[model samples]
Target chain A: MFDTVNLEDARRVIAAAEKKAAAIGQPMNIAVADAGGNLVAHVRMDGAWLGSIDISIKKAYTSRAFDIATKDLATHSQSGNQFFGIHASNNGKIMIFAGGIPLKRDGRVVGAIGVSGGSGEQDHAVAEAGAAAL
Target chain B: MFDTVNLEDARRVIAAAEKKAAAIGQPMNIAVADAGGNLVAHVRMDGAWLGSIDISIKKAYTSRAFDIATKDLATHSQSGNQFFGIHASNNGKIMIFAGGIPLKRDGRVVGAIGVSGGSGEQDHAVAEAGAAAL
Candidate 1:
């Protein structure tokens, strides 16, 4: 009843994210969730920060929930914006920072990828790589 | 990152659940999450109940969150019990019912498995099969 990322694509996304993290010399926690915000894939690098594990998963959930990259959401979540309190609304699972990107299939979002354990720019870059794997 | 359930193990858990589900002639939605309550893997078998997708994931999260099986938690969630109304907490993600089981290694909880789209007893049995794959 719903368009979702298949298992094969989910693993491909994770592999791309892992490659980017290694290229950047930063370990990362990566997560992928279907359009329904259901987890499809996950990975924690050998040296990634443990705390970033949940953040990565939550970022993917938030991206799939909103159909937008978290960096864009970060702008709208700033003070006095339409979604100002959005992060605090979803049981503190909304990730307004960078590192979350929705995956598109024929111009429609089918899933999202999230990466953490680095600067916002680095995280976003890795997430972008994951999305590019589509 | 800390030692967590790898992606391979997460897939193995799902396959085990699928095998049990098939043997029983019932489809299922299975979920696996690491000890931190972060999602690791999820699969919704053909003809499975859509509603059970979220339930499966939440059951896994609840199991990992408390390090106890949902079957055991159900007892504590009974009326007048210590954890009554526990389902209303954590954004209503708690599944104080059967089908959730924690995955252990060296006697420490490392992750959890959950199965839905079946009776509580059936779900519990499927979840146990998934956990045994570890």
Candidate 2:
């Protein structure tokens, strides 16, 4: 198995996401997961929606579990797609939506970040910033 | 809803659980969930079983959702019990196993902790240490 995410990397990702969230004027719940789809770090900004906490973590979990961005999962999980109703599986942990991206190191998936408490486009932008920090 | 769990508390709980796990010579995957059954924090220690990561998080979620210990849930979900086959429901997120316990404050469930990567008794012991931190 590949090396899992460490605390430092997870913190860096969250910090980048937090900066982006602040720049975009949105409070965010950010989550990072290791290659094994286990959470490594998380941050819920004050005034962020409580409901977004789980959504963010599950999105990060989903991204790391599949080694794919959640946006890709969204297409695959759509009606008549190969992974239809995939969200209903995995105890609703599979989030087929935007705002989740995997972090790659030397062409290998090292971890992932998921952002919530903003529009999908905003969340995706912030998550991309986090991934860029990897 | 009441106030959600703070990040400091989650970290403290994990630290306590880690100490207990190390005392027993078992690396562990520890997870904490807020009262709404959402993951707040998680850690998979070095050399911990990868399969236990998701199980630990689900155990925490199940405990918070039901406001009871997973061991109690295990008993209630046994053959001829009222919650028989409960594990198959909730998209298989219900972990009717030991090592999951709620964090209660003033008799109200605030959050939960779950530990894995050892015997059920050992896991339970570690999780108890986590809950005691609350």
Candidate 3:
């Protein structure tokens, strides 16, 4: 049976990402989604815009739903056939772009983490930190 | 000088609301917005549809921005001049209906709380629990 992602693991990932962001002096919003595309945890830093929360969750949802990193989806959407429409089809819940990465354990994807509020590159960096912590 | 609402206060309100919902066995999504209409905290219970998050936040935004309970706006929009358009003008960030109430301290509005993921009456009841906790 596939077990649900542990909430403590998700919090550790977020803490690691926050530490990295703090080191860079950037505030961000982070969201974690379980393998079932259900939200596990979310945090929005004190200066981060409220919109970042939605964007971060969308990115995480896209990563978990597609079972791939959001960065790769951004590249594919630009070249694939009517791929961008997939986001609209999902009731605008999926965001195909950087800043979201699937979490893996023993080569199996368990969940996804997304970070937003900074530039794409910065957001990607923060997401990577979260993934690395896992 | 006005006192800024502390995060602990918000958490207490949310806890009370959650306890009430637990007693009723209804899952919910709740959002709290600060004096500046910015999200201070948000919680999504398991089994609550993801869409509830957006609806809750929009209700809180509408309550805070309009300086009235969201339930009142629903009634006014049906009989008043171009009132429903106000929600559209706000970039779809406001929802006019029940389930939201502004937080008051010393007779001044300090913030707002919104609840969703159940019947309108249930949502309103949960929000009232949050407000009463304050």
Could you give candidate 1's per-residue lDDT for residues A4-51 as a string of tens digits? 886568878988999999999998988888877876656777668878
CAPRI level of candidate 3:
incorrect
Q: What is the TM-score of chain B in candidate 2?
A: 0.96
- Candidate 2: residue pairs that collide: none
Off by over 4 Å in 1: A1-3, A23-25, A36-47, A64-66, A76-93, B1-8, B22-27, B33-54, B64-67, B80-93, B106-109
* Model 1 per-residue lDDT tens digits across residues B1-67: 5557866788888888889999999988888888677766676776677688779989999999999
- Error in Å for residue B117 of model 3: 2.1
Worst 10 residues of 2 chain A by lDDT: A38-47
Q: Could you tell which candidate, 2 or 3, scores higher by lDDT?
A: 2
Instruction: Decide which is better by DockQ, 1 or 3.
Output: 1
Q: Which CAPRI quality tier does the interface of model 2 achieve? A: acceptable
Model 1 chain B: weakest 10-residue lDDT segment is B38-47
DockQ of each: 0.25, 0.25, 0.21
lDDT of 2 by residue, B1-134 (tens): 69667767788899999989989899998988877777777777777887888889899989988988998999999999999998998887889999999998888888899888898999999999999988
Arrange candidates, best lDDT first. Answer: 1, 2, 3
List the TM values for chain B, per candidate.
0.97, 0.96, 0.92
Expressed as tens digits, the lDDT of each residue in A4-44 for candidate 3 is 56656777888898888888888898888888887766777
